[model samples]
Target: MKAASKKTAGTIALNDRREICNVPEPSTTRLNKRMAELGMCSRREADDWIARGWVRVDGQVAPMGLQVAADARIDVDPKARGQQQEQVTILLNKPIGYVSGQAEDGYQPAVVLVEERNHWRGDASKTRFAPQQLRGLAPAGRLDIDSIGLLVLTQDGRIARQLIGEDSGMEKEYLVRVTYGDVAADVQSAFPRAQLMRLRHGLSLDNQPLKPAQVDWQNPEQLRFVLTEGKKRQIRRMCEQVGLKVVGLKRIRIGRVLLGNLPVGQWRYLAPQERF
Candidate 1:
């Protein structure tokens, strides 16, 4: 049989019997993406929940790759919420010689310090340490192996997304000990004000403009840097560009969280009421 074509305007012919009127595309998004955008969980987490029948859309169990309207009511199963609550976030005072993520070139990763023995005695959080907490635990951000101070490791996807996501604007504060040329003492007096200004706003790295930073002399040989972005070896490279040689670097803060009194190579659980 020959299929019929639509001869009329504003209509599309599907077959010999059916004709459909033209309509605007519906505003919808993938369920996983929508869940991530809503900050419920990461896209990967959403996919896992959907696969386990733990997610519902409009009161129906959501299928993988399902498209949902922007206004759709999405609910996560209580089991999924329970799992999320069990996930932990760890803060470590990553000493020099440990990589932020994976072990490489004979260097141990920072997470190795999260064992029970290394747990900080000063940690006020009552959460007990368990071997299961190590499973899926990973670094949320990178700190150079030679650098020291606050390094966040987590099993929670939401905290990871909040700290290192593509659109994240979390501030990382560093105290850098530097020397100006042959002047290690009173180097701030020799450093140019214009160079300091460049460090604050006008510098570029990797062929891209750096976002304005809060850079100021903390002492004669130390500079305090607060930056919103973390390019690889960013602080060292920025100092090099301005003729400053970094001898030491320590991160003191990330967002509102501080690395206060945490001994080197020690780890602590992020307190329940504490947030990054």
Candidate 2:
């Protein structure tokens, strides 16, 4: 038997079937949050577009703090909604040639080193750098192009903030090889069995002043230095000022984290319990 169509007060077209329905009172959810729930874009992106007057809800412009019914007509401008959502974090044992962030005149940024094959899948091997995890990942800290060491790229802002924030207590350790112009006899005597050296009163020819440093011999030619703050070309400059020319400089650790045997140009995860 064919059903009779009642007087249509309102209509909802679902799966190509037109059905008569009552028009319930309109309800609302915060526009920015609603946009994010739809997975269309980030909440911040929605807020920016709404302020630019580009988002429309129920066929009208959306204003900040304005709410709209969940089922209301909503449209994001063509140019507004960006590309597919993919967040990635790539830990790279950055080699000497690549810059840390933006491109320089001829050098490529390190982020490009992450290849599709490295994209992290749930599998152990694939989780190294996942395609889906690439969305908002960025370099949390920096490594000089001339320096080879551990570099971290991450989507976690809290981790990034903790590691590189100005007030961060994280320590960066380096292995430096130095060649001195004229070795001070006292320094050579102090250097041999010394686990620590203080350059306070200052090293002078009569007595040259050197900044205090915690230095330890890694080998006859190398010294390990641990510092909490990083300044531009700090180690190199410090070595030069002390009458020692730095022939090689490598960052071997950051906080309790070691660059380890990851190999040059390779990277791995800091174990779950690892914290800076």
Candidate 3:
């Protein structure tokens, strides 16, 4: 006797003649793309390999723009990974007069901060300056060419984002040495005893009381200024308005990072775990 038919499960099957696989498709993607997803080679390099017929999929030569299953046999030519692993980060106590990124008339790029002669034997080979690395490397933040202080240059993107981001909230501290002409005691009395002065009355005060400055006697004529923000020639400008002249300006710290005892014109590799 013939058996009775079962009720339909109500699922419609796709009926396309071009469909090749009975397997419900492994989320179709390209071989070159798959290689890139595996962190093997860049997508552009992967495409070039495919064009050269060097890329294989399940043992068949693949073409540029060919589509393949997400999981496919993939291999990259030996040089595709290139020399990116040797990326480095250098921290320099930048001296006056070196532009941070690109060289301009009469001045050198801060990158020269590490001339070949300065490269220690253990540092990466001359290939350290390879073009691919330079594309991602830059000074994470700036120190004006006229100023002297700790400047950071790095190949890492995360640190750069942190240092220059608007909400970075990093405190940069400076020690400014200033000298003042003899001012009548009345003028001095009108201003707070802070190393920075606020024009309290009948005065032009533009800055916000100069960031809550601290005053201390360095000598009868000289005062030491410590500040958190490095506005343009701010110490010099402030001193000029108060009958004083800035003789020296030096940055001592950025966030918890310090200038330490590092000598002028020298640099050190940032410790691998160091940030901010």
Candidate 4:
């Protein structure tokens, strides 16, 4: 007839079938890690919430470094959510001579341009500028001090992770002006098609093979590159390998966000409706 089942300490026995199945215990993960996995906040933010008693697990206040089951209920205090909402993401038209991150060798960082006076007048975002927003504000991605274009700075951890996380595959588009040896104008016609194909794939950097990229001629002297990974001065270095020298490089887009007529050295708040 039907198999009769019985439960033992760590196994389930089917009497008629003479079969047994092991019952494994639920796996546990660190409290902060579990919270981050759920997309609630970053691990650092989760730890801060736990320390502030803003996080609860299974209806009890979660302690720092606590281990929790995957199914455990996580409740975040309203204060934590309010603080997250206050965080801001700014898009800047970074100009040359400014480093993307920290000030180095007497060069100012791009974030210094995010002051009230530099706010884009054409910006339609309703968010007002506040000095407090500058605290913890850092670049989400790097744009070399010598190159200029769209650069992102933010106080929101989520945006930082979204833009530069290890697994992130966001596309960054650039317009690169290049010249070949003695050919500065109309170099595209002189450049071989096979070398252009090599730029699109089969290129290696830092001893590692680079992911395939979208590389094409934007004009006679300019090449348009769309890459999902950002290495240090990647466009310049990539041009060098193909017997081309980069004269100018500008990042035009990141994900779906564009540099779009935002004046150089000016900044604007990322609108709520815009993503990426």
Candidate 5:
């Protein structure tokens, strides 16, 4: 069962095409948080809907951030569903030198590469390019300006929450090329196995324990890492702890979706049938 279905009762919002499932039991938590827990929307989006009187509890408009009972029947206005339908998700093979969120110091943001001309010809999605698709679109998860690979940008709050929310469980896989300073020393031999163990389970960042990650050597100079959480330049920091320097990094997949041959600096739509 989904975590949100623990105690709450849910009904599809009127006129909604997709079932409004996953509404969480209120259980004394803030209303915005409850909506996010249910996978309804991100907390920020929930707050916006509540403020607009687009959210309801037991068929009545909900008050902003109100705390309520576990069994409250939460509902969203049809306008919310309409708004959701307009959202789009884009996948990009980000090349180095472009920031994920915004431009800085003369460097452009990766979204600038999401132009009509950059749409991959092999994309199976028949959705035509529209300037409106760029409106309100933001990076759901960030990739370092120095790294390259799959970078997700979207207007959908649900997709954003699914990938980067506080409680998200989606996995991101990356291939990294590393250097350990000594030209003749192999990283696997020079970097102690115990440190690898720490990379898998014992490491912490910002005074909090990092979620366990899958880290293993892909080749003599490359490592494969799969992580459930992202911190600022996390992999690079983790490598530093073990005396390894990350020379190159490329995200290969997010959840079940692979970046697969999407040329750098190009993008494609996230197909309707794909979930992550």
Candidate 6:
């Protein structure tokens, strides 16, 4: 996306480090994007503030996707920060049969389980809920309908960007229950050492090599998988390559936050002090 000219609106082209760079094109780009590139907030939040006339560039109120130099000065009213502070991030111990985002094929989204009554009683966070909290709340990362464990949904773009951004490096840990497909050995003995090593380092999906993953046996039937990148149905596919069938999967952690004691179908707020 090219940035708009000084008088128009356009898109931003981000470099390898995600720094916004000016393209040679004359048209201007989206102002929300420029704000996001500056590390202030997500594009969605930027648009909200821009609509409210909370952003200014070069001493003038910013218009939608206003074109400016890559290094242009942009100022946001302090009110934006206060609104961002009220945005919430929710942690759910999503149960099986719930989709992480929108509903599909008659199955419900995990967010529907986040009603006030469903708030975890053991949660230490004191944040209370309002009907508006559910508005625009979205899953930051996906949890498969067949899986159970920690799933994040947030109204804060900063948290969403940190967890699922294209360049995010946060680690996600899972406990997967698998079974041997071959008849020669039970779950414990069927997998060879070489195959396990491949699960850790030597595999590719869709012709692209996979990033190194931490794959280890947790018990006779369970494997612990810690990965930095998520491809569609990645773990199950990796196990299939090793002649193993996944029977169950559960995510336990994301970065420093743990699934903890949040019961299935229940959710809690990410504490103000929490980083992930």
Best TM-score goes to which candidate? 1
Local accuracy of candidate 2 as per-residue lDDT tens digits, 21-55: 54455577899878766655556667877888889
Model 1 segments more than 4 A misplaced: 1-24
lDDT of 2 at 202: 36
* Candidates 1 and 4, the one with greater TM-score: 1
- Residue 112, candidate 2: Cα error in Å is 1.6
Q: State which candidate has the highest lDDT.
A: 1
State the local distance difference test value for candidate 6.
0.87
For 147-224, candidate 3 gives per-residue lDDT tens digits of 687788876544554566544556666665554454433333433464343411222336444454544444544454
Candidate 6 TM-score, C-alpha based: 0.86
Local distance difference test scores for all models: 0.93, 0.64, 0.60, 0.91, 0.88, 0.87
Q: Give the TM-score of candidate 5.
A: 0.83
- As a whole number from 0 to 100, the lDDT of residue 154 in candidate 3 is 75
Candidate 4, TM-score vs. the true structure?
0.89
Models, CA RMSD each = 3.6, 16.7, 12.7, 6.3, 11.2, 7.4
lDDT, candidate 1, equals 0.93
Across 136-252, the per-residue lDDT of candidate 5 in tens digits comes to 889989999999999999988888988998888899999998888774347777777888898898888899899999999998778899999999999999988877889999999
Score residue 190 of candidate 4 by CA lDDT: 97
What tens-digit string does per-residue lDDT give for candidate 4 at 106-221?
99988889899999999999999999999989999999888989999988878887888888999999999999999999999999999999999999999999999999999999
Report the Cα lDDT for candidate 2: 0.64
Candidate 1 residues 15-114, lDDT tens each?
3234245454578999999998889988888999999999999999999999999999999999999999999999999999999999999999999888
| Per-model TM-score on C-alpha atoms | 0.92, 0.56, 0.52, 0.89, 0.83, 0.86
Clashes of 3: 0
Give the candidate order by descending lDDT: 1, 4, 5, 6, 2, 3
Regions more than 4 Å wrong, model 2: 1-89, 116-128, 182-213
User: How high a TM-score does candidate 3 get?
Assistant: 0.52
What is the lDDT, from 0 to 100, of the residue 213 in candidate 6? 99
